[model samples]
Target: MGVPVASGASPLDAHELLRKGEVSRALVLFEKMHDPRRPDPAVLAGLVESRLALGEAHRVAPLMPHLADAALHAPSKDHHTGLAHWALAGLAELEGDHDRAAGHFRSAGEAGPDDPDLLPWRAGLALALTRQGRSPEAVRLAHEHLTRARASGSAYARALALRTLAAVDGASSRRDLLTQALEELEGIQATRLRAQVLTDLAGVLVLLHEDRGPGVIRLLREAELIAVRSRLRPLLDRVRRLLTRLDQPAGSTAPPGLEGLTPSELRVVELAASGLTNREIAGRLVVTVKAVEWHLSNVYRKLGISGRKELPT
Candidate 1:
């Protein structure tokens, strides 16, 4: 039998773990390679990406400039430079700087031309374009990449292309595209990507039905569970916001007596106002009793009431 890898794996091993969504283990391995004297570009890039994926964007901000300089001035034109740029782009995207992200993705493509048959740069560009409101260009680029990915039989590429398409498509087509994307991700070990797909799928489901039907709530709950279990803070925050949004009725403003409360607080107030006890309201809102109590306390304080007995009666 071949020799087994040591407990402390190499940078390649760490990168492979990161790619497979074993981020915590990968971070432990990559941290061992941190050498300021002569930094390994591969290890640096992988560590940065692993940190980003784990929602530690702020933690890695100080090293981004150095990483960018190294990527831009690298000796070889290969995966290291491309990955460095991709990591930078991801950070920019997380910070809500689409322009910077687009520039970095372009630089990545320049550093190492994307494999059109597999993971195409055009696909990433299309997603950025979609966010920038260049839907027509995004659609065209997505079709090109999707066609090539399908022909090449790359499930990961096809899923990515489909998700890009779904983001730019109209509501009707968007639903179908997201559905197909989830199907592609379902068979893979990319748990983070799967959670993202589930979030997008939940968004589409909500759009398709304004009532926050059972199906939509179910999808969102699944996504939320994954985000929480993986400790993906960004996605967890997103899922919570989506849940809060769905809880409110369309064009719903606070009731006349409860005008000052926020949408979420107003929701709890309305549920309670409808004669639902604390336990019932908690169940209806899918929240804990403490959360329900907190909102009720805020509501009582704002309304200048001693108890629920004085609420709108």
Candidate 2:
């Protein structure tokens, strides 16, 4: 009988363990491996994913060149190369380089022609386009992605697509379409989606409410909460500014105490008072878009204001 030799774990095993959050075990096993070139694309991808989860984008950047080279050299194109592009796009998006992000996302989509995972990137590209003032193109791309996402019945993808649609609709002042988009988001139970919907809804309501009274305040407050919970700093900032504008008295010289605002609330309020948008506020505060909204909602409720026009003077 042949004796069985005890051996260390495999790279695939390490990758799986890492996916399950067993980082230490994965590292130990991975370190024991001798051939750097031996790890499969899946293993490499997993390592990249692990690094991303650990918030190490910078570390992941160096691996991309190798990943790209590996993909180009492989006899048959695999999904790994496409995934690398996706990762690059995500990193760019996080860094607020939308143009670069869009380019990478497009490349990823071409690499993985039928990948469902790429839907989010497509939707993101559409959003970026809209933000860049390419409304017609954004709407077209959003509709295309929305059709695919709806057909796939992917809750996450659908929610993202709906948000993109809402953005497009909001830009065009198509309230009915935006309303439908909000309903779609609500159906998905996506709190982040709801935050975005509320923010857009509040903005629309503000425009519709000529008096800018308690009703506007109520909408803004609701939007604020949703944004904060979702860490949507941009929406939160918008809500805050809307609130401050509402609070300003016709002839008042000084801004009011903006009573009931928590520290975060005060921060948002101050930013809003300075006329910053939600996106800008989020960047300045280094908070998620949702967090900004949450604070804004709290601020509105505490002040007993109904509209942006009713904020303390």
Candidate 3:
């Protein structure tokens, strides 16, 4: 049998490296393990982290069944169950199942309130709630997560929590809180975290543009650069749409490609931009879900936007 690492260099060390952003080192350690059956839950979780950091979500999914089964059958109940739920929640978020995502996040939070990862899951849940028009509850829950993250001293958690706070605060017209979120994000150095926060700040700026015009444009441009460099496509799309809307001149003609969209497609785009699901859009448009999906596909092709997140207002 293969022996475990001695003293300070244990599987937990590998997990620590993963948490500290040393992804290559963590992956190397995980690859050297002798037996899959002997793998520490922390090491398995680190593997998940490494894959997620690389944006390999499909790869991460295969491991979820194994991890979930282990967590469910383990002798003692622990944070692993929560981690599994959070992983599934992340997949749901990527698939745009906001309701399911929120449920999973809530389960994760209740199972592992002290887990650093749970803070981000809670923040994500709060953002979903905000998008679903539960602004007051969203604001309250976001602040609660922010408080926990700050107390935990996890920079990643703090950054995500701040982004959620910015979103909720923007929705509730709390400009001062959004300003504070922007200032907090300015000091974070991680590229992915910085890119996400800059995107959130740009969004808040867009909401506040009535009182601050060029200022919002400047922030959006900065966010655009960061997002492009970081290869964060979702945030990049948001920045692009925000800049496009901001740059439209008063009484300007519709752009060339946008002019080709049918009125129904345009309405679908508007609702999609507001975060409505195809089913909801279908109900609003008095059409079948498949019809709404068809319109959205055509709209996406005409607009050259790949994701619903990129739909124009």
Candidate 4:
């Protein structure tokens, strides 16, 4: 049974709960309002997002077919479609499916072309494009979003847009843009955003000072702290690996390929190497077959391998 909300409680309140990291409460609210027969796109999006954050992706993966045609599902509510697309885009990006992320983000924009809330979604598309080896397009898109972010006069949105531009720019320009973003983030509740920028800034600083050893550990350490406190598993894992890299001697850590594998990817690779098929692995891990495939894809890319045959047993 789902927990009931008090009288006058709004769905937006559920979204706020999720944002505030009260994911269980948010899940209760979304589930309480959810109707399986005619799923509310917004509630469905929130449901999946909350479950994913809580490490229960399998529970929601079966519902993905409903979200696959968000526009058709919410024909009368363009914002509902936009919200669903945005949620799916974020999940795709996290899974390293840049093409899918870009496509879904585009769908979001088409759903709500003039919505200010779409600015950050555009920034997400920029990052996805960057990963797909289209840095020029990414830079152009981020710059356009930055202009809109500035015009809107929302420092939080502007900071995010600036961070996107920084991500696509050269190292020197990256530093300047990220610094400007940090300036805008001051006194804001954007802990995740701040941690991300700090991580990027630390990487840029390390690249610029190759002669030095872990001089920017302070920055990365702060990011690590924030990610841990916020329960940002993916970012926390990344920060831990980066921290390991910075702290260890050049030859002390695993090979670059092994080092790059996220904990989730490493687990997938291990299971595959142990002679488990993707379907078996998905069942074992309580994730979707698609999720298992996504992990393998990331593993293959990081390890520079061709396919399942190349994975170590």
Candidate 5:
């Protein structure tokens, strides 16, 4: 509905649709173009990715061997080959094969180190390293890629780099990196990636334990809402699991910047911290947007913060 791309759509159209979270539409396009005996590696990879994102693990499992075979026959320098490897890496990660995933990600990276299109490979490798308990190396790799991502000025790249850094920096720092990642993701209209980042941010908040209980709970709640709205089952389940952990009783401690605020003001502050715009917050609360803005203004004044970005997470 957003774009008339389905008519005579190409793989690029499918890719764009996938980026926009129209997984079913993208799948239709890919299925129309796919050949059983000689599948295009790029389209096959995209199909695999869409299925995985939709929580169709059974479907993706059956497709894996074919996708791998296609990747095997693909040329070394072919970008489609790299994409196939990237899809394989994702599948490996899903199966908890960190070593294999890292290897595949490395292959993806080698296929096009400076192609300006393999940021996902770099980010995936960094995540794989973190999962393998190589956080220091992950941090270093992610830092280098963060520099490149910043230079690219692409929000997606920056969000990935920020998420990677947040994953690697779990124990060493507070929730700043993950918070920045949330801010970056919130600015984008990509629901799928935003849900993923929200899930990651919830996990990071649980690990950090630096934020107040109320605020952390609020952030996780927002993430759960988004995950459910986006139908991202994996992230939705994760947010639910993390919320259980947060619900367990812990020592009560209110984080700074929230002192002396009424419950209404506090709620506004929490929503803002979780990266919702005033209009969104109003819609969520069934209140007027002007009322939401007024509440946020009071919250900022009380917290001595100037903007939504300055809200404490």
Candidate 6:
């Protein structure tokens, strides 16, 4: 189903809306321009990205069939086909299918120009790998991606690379990377991307020095403001979820420097520090390995460590 492209409604404006984090408006224009019988690849790509950005996965699910048409259209400077795969990778990541997301991210590079592979998909792939417990390669790939992004001289690319690196890295190095990302992003008007980077930077600040964390509440608050202003439901949900996870209950005394952690998280840390594998700890705690990993990830962000091996015995 396609509505007539509105008079003077340029696709460039739609793309710009995405860049500015005005995804709801971008989606409207893309929808008006899409024609199923002779689909526009750029429109299809934009539609998918905009829908997913707004947390409208259910909307995109039914429209997935239209994505294939991206390959059938001429390759624009935007590399519509590559973007289709890239957007699909994001959708898979949202669905918690990192294996599937990794595959699509790789295919995104092979599709053609738009050169997302060199700029950002490698970082995406690295994150997907990290989620699957392939940390060694993930770290290597993300660092390499950041290096390439720096060499390419695109601040936006560098910011994207740094943000992903921040996620995959297990050390205090992340704060510097996140700080650099915020600086690079400062010059760009990519609102949605900036919001995410801000959130990451704020997370590092919170877990590492709880005493100083709330002082930088401005960052997370700013991100939340952006999400709300843009009607970015998914981003808003993520921000709230993060706050909920990090918040301590009233009167619960967390260990020094671990003020954001809950009693359950503290228990996980204790078991992990005893030289037990995540699996071993999960069994003892009657929780999933992912739960253990999540707790350990928080600890690593604060303590500059990796997994159990780095924890004190």
- Write model 1 residue lDDT over 1-313, tens digit each, in one string: 0111246667878776665566655665665576766666677777787777667776787667767777768854676677777777777877888888888778777877466532266777778878898888878878887887787776777787787777766543877787898788777777666777778888866766743777777777776766644445677777777788778322223334556777677666645554567886687568999999999899899989987766662
**Alpha-carbon local distance difference test for all models:** 0.70, 0.58, 0.62, 0.71, 0.70, 0.71
Clashing pairs for model 6 are none
Off by over 4 Å in 3: 1-58, 75-77, 113-119, 131-136, 153-158, 169-171, 186-188, 211-214, 247-313
Please list the residue runs of candidate 2 whose C-alpha ends up more than 4 Å from where it truly belongs after superposition: 1-87, 90-96, 113-118, 131-133, 169-173, 207-215, 229-235, 248-313
Q: Which stretches of candidate 5 lie over 4 Å from their true place?
A: 1-5, 113-119, 170-174, 212-214, 248-313
lDDT of 4: 0.71
State the lDDT of candidate 2 residue by residue for 1-313, as single tens digits: 0011115566566655543334433433443452456545444555565555434455567566655665556444446556556666666766788787778667666766554433355776786676667788878988888788888866556656666676775555545555666666554444544555665666666667743777656666766665443334555666677777788322211124543456567667655543455675687568988887777777778877664344432
Provide the lowest-lDDT 10-residue window in model 3: 248-257
Q: List all candidate RMSDs to the true structure.
A: 13.7, 15.1, 14.0, 12.0, 13.2, 17.4
Candidate 1, residue 216: CA error in Å? 1.6
Q: Which candidate is the best by TM-score?
A: 5
Off by over 4 Å in 4: 1-8, 17-28, 50-60, 94-96, 210-215, 248-313
The clash number for model 6 is: 0
Compared to the true structure, candidate 3 yields what TM-score? 0.58
Give the lowest summed-lDDT range of ten residues in model 4. Answer: 248-257
| Weakest 10 consecutive residues of candidate 2 by summed lDDT | 248-257
**Per-prediction TM-score to the true structure, in the order listed:** 0.70, 0.50, 0.58, 0.68, 0.71, 0.69
- CA shift of 131, model 3, Å: 4.5
What is the C-alpha lDDT profile of model 6 across 1-313, one tens digit per residue?
1112345776667877777666755776776677888766667778888878766677777656666556435463346666777777877898899998998777776675534323267888999999999998999988888888888877778888889889998963888888888899886777888999888877777678742346456676677777755557777776766666557222223434555666676666655553456886687568999998888888777777765566532
Cα distance off (Å), candidate 2, residue 11: 17
